[model samples]
Target: MTNELELKQWYQLLFGKIDSALLELKDYDGNYYWDSVDPNSLRYFVSNIVGTPWQNHMGLSLLSVTDRKLSPQSIYNLMSTINARLKNLFAAAELSEMVEFNYSVVEKYLTGSLMPDHTDRQRQSFLTAYGSFIFNVSKWITTQFTNEQQSYFSKFLFPKLPFDNRDFSVRTKALDVAKETRKTETSAVTPQLPEIRAESHFRWNQVHRLRKAMRDVLEKARHDRITLPLEFSYDESEYTNERWHFVLWDKESFGRYYKVGTSSENEVFLEFVRAENLDDGRPGDGLWFLEILRLRLIGIWDQEYLEDNERLKIVEYLNQWGYEDAVQGQAPFQIRNPGLLTQSVFIVRNSRKFDKLLINLEPIYVACTFARFALDIITSSGARMNELLQISYDKNCCIVTVDNSVTPPSKNYIYRLIPKGREEEENYYMPEEVYRFMSDIVNLLKESYNSSSIPEVEYSAATRKHLMSKKRYIFQYKGRHINEFTINAIIRFLLHGTIIQTSEGNQVVLKAHLLRHAFATHAVQTEKIPIDIVKSLLHQKDISVTEYYSAPTHQQISDTVG
Candidate 1:
């Protein structure tokens, strides 16, 4: 048998340590006391009724209950016996009033065990968890009660009781108050700062010209063995053949012609033939400039330019020069060299200052271009990074299919890219911008890998085989597959200064998941796409999953009503 004072001390030891731990939890710490640093931020080490699996170790140290002296089993048995009696009383309650009364008794015992110095947050948490626990346990006890026993208990528990007033929602109300208090404190300490403006797309505008930039970097990489931060190294190319390198048109005559072909050497010249001479193989009079005007750029490409109007003006200039015009006299119109497009754009945007400064595009700049492309695809498509990475050069497309049959697990199938970890393959069509950039990357990879100008490797067959297999994955770094961690790192580096202030005025890192939400929300709420289609695009098994992603734009509650 245990003394009353000893029992009370034991209860204090258990609940006191728990309260202390709860108070110690810091929201801004690198690691939270009760939470894990994962997507869910799941509460660990502590919960409403018990602690984590490792609680026994904590209990032993706190209680100082050694096996040589006090029996831990005896204390556990005593608590279990008390709990059994409480369960009996719980099972006997039939009426809501009786249930609430029994719950109050349990609450008194639990609250009595808490230390007097408990923090407000810890107190509120305890109350909320206690209420929730009572509500759950009452449900279990209600199931076991006989009709007659329940009636007896209910009648006695509420024997001609006078009208009473007690708010069961007090715990919830206290939580709201606690949250407001915390928010006010946080906001006062860290007021909202000015928004950080994004870097100009001057570099992104050079994506088309990035091919030359990459080659320049590779050439520089050869001479100096300059170590780039991304640790992966490029293998030596086959030096016996001259396949790796391509000759560039002189900067002076860069825009003389445009060539499109499957291979670098054998390009099919898209000649401008007059409508009357369409069937003939002969080229029309120096009408090559007409083809330049007909080139339709993807919408995203134009965004790389600082201003839409400026890009539009450039397009207009190219199109404004047709020979069919009534103005017969032709003036000498200077053709801007494509090689100096970036410099030309800079000059035009800078009030035609006639600045002769040349922009040297580095290798890091080329790598960032790929990173931006990856970000674009993931954000626009609402596809998982893994799913997007599964897209092989030849198999890139986007098509969604729906199956209604119950057998074989019915689901909406997104066709085109084969899903990672699934055996099934489907046909789909991707957005044009994605297709174009991804195809360009494929060509770039082929050129880099098969280039004869690079020396052949002196590595083992296993290493060679591994490098060859890396071709299967779209995102490769120096013959190795670039994983999700590297992609996220690249994104973080690119968006270093970006920040978003919360209602509490706390600034948080802009995560990739935010971009995922941006895609879904834009599709469902902004673009007003059908909810079912949104679900299909997101690859969510249930419509409810998409609802979280498509929360409505915030507005005052009063404004929402008439």
Candidate 2:
């Protein structure tokens, strides 16, 4: 059990720490208490992002309130339900009500006031608030039924009371949210600052790997390691193999271009891109300009210049050109090179920026660790970091293994295990990285087939039944990014948090997944493993046509290691 007095002081410290950062937020404002770094500021954020996303989360949030005559009762219900539950939680025994409390939460929703996503600007606070709400609801009910059981004889030990009723309505609300969500950018309702940076970092790391691959190809070509050019051009006879390295383009003005591709019948099909003519703008353009300038750019470049509107303007320019009539004898902008077009557009609104963040090493540590020790017992032993979040260890493995029988199946499909006491991966140790994640969560395994750690409600009967024969790993949440889907998501809450101010007055806590990328990359590097091993470890393979989906063995990584 947590120390009551210490915990209270801790929460007070949390509140005081966040409260000091905001100028507009009153000390007792209810918004600050949730997970967002700065709640007050988040109420107003700059939503300059322009696009028609399939499902616009920010747009729906505004429309959810704007479209409906959502009474204060609706908001009150959101808050009260959250409030009542928080009040009853055992974990927050020392946590008392903050100011305006229920009314503040409900008031915005009740009055149909524009409520941007609290999570955007105030991630931690929003999560804190969201968690507090969930914690309060669950804890209170658990307390009333568990500790104060006799007094609540009116209901069964488990209340069939419609938790799903509210949950279901939230699903419907999303559809309604979709319809009511405005397509156009609105100054009236700005989004909160995006707070999911940790996740964003993980996505960006994949881009880093791709960048590295491009660099390797270019460097090899430059060194005359191959006869071909850096980026092998389809029209190498006419176009030198040209590549765009960042340093070359840093000082040069960059733009987009449109190309006319030939179809089977030689029909012209126009294609648009955020670059100059393929033949004209490769390495030579940037390199040529840099040579003339004779000056290397000083100071740190932002790495992602594409986000700058000056660069992104190329797209919009193309849009305008589509409507432009010949001003003189031809279009206003001339193609410096053959039949190619170039305009300026660097950033695609709502398009993700590839800013690499730190990838936490913990989870990768977990998967590799398990693979190392379990190799002797398994068919072929190599682990992917992904399986950590959604792996389910089969019952047959537990029968002989004997060590991990009582573990609860995951809410998601994450389960993994090896044969009892076997640890040889093609006669080598599995990567050490995965061991760490497993070491942290291995304690939950039980002696019986019955689940001891996981809650059955989180999963469906079909899933649970499957896990009855399998062991499951559970992450707090799971999702996917570019290239591939992430199967397992464990320990999402485990991270160092940072705070940033929002345009409104909210503060948000951001995590470190870019760091995790660094960690995963470094881990493979440390192990002296090959890029393919890294590729397998990261689950980025799409060679799904044959049986390439199966991860390679330790030997593969070992042989490929640089």
Candidate achieving the largest TM-score = 1
> Candidate 2's residue-wise lDDT over 1-562, tens digit each?
2244234432343332222222112112433222322221122212221121201222222223222323322333333333333333312233233322343343233223324322122222232234333333344434323443334322211222223223323334554553222211111111211223232233223323433454455566558755332222221122323343321111011121212222222111111111234556643432111210111111111234435553334334322322122211222222122111111112111112222111212223332223222321111123323222233333322221222445653221122332112222111122233333344334422311244553222221111122322224332212111010111111111111222333343332211222223323333444555656544444443434112222332333546784
Show model 1 residue runs off by greater than 4 Å.
Answer: 1-203, 206-363, 396-415, 418-423, 426-429, 451-471, 503-505, 553-562
Q: What would the TM-scores of all predictions be? A: 0.35, 0.23
Give the count of colliding residue pairs in each prediction. 13, 89
Deviation of model 2 at 285, angstroms: 12
For candidate 1, which ten residues in a row score worst on lDDT? 36-45
Residue-by-residue lDDT tens digits, candidate 1, 349-441: 222232222222333344455566666665556766655555544323333344556666543323255433343544333455555666556
The lDDT for every candidate, in the order shown, is 0.38, 0.27
The alpha-carbon deviation from the true structure for residue 179 of candidate 2, after best TM-score superposition, in angstroms, is 9.4
Model 1, position 536, has a per-residue lDDT of 73
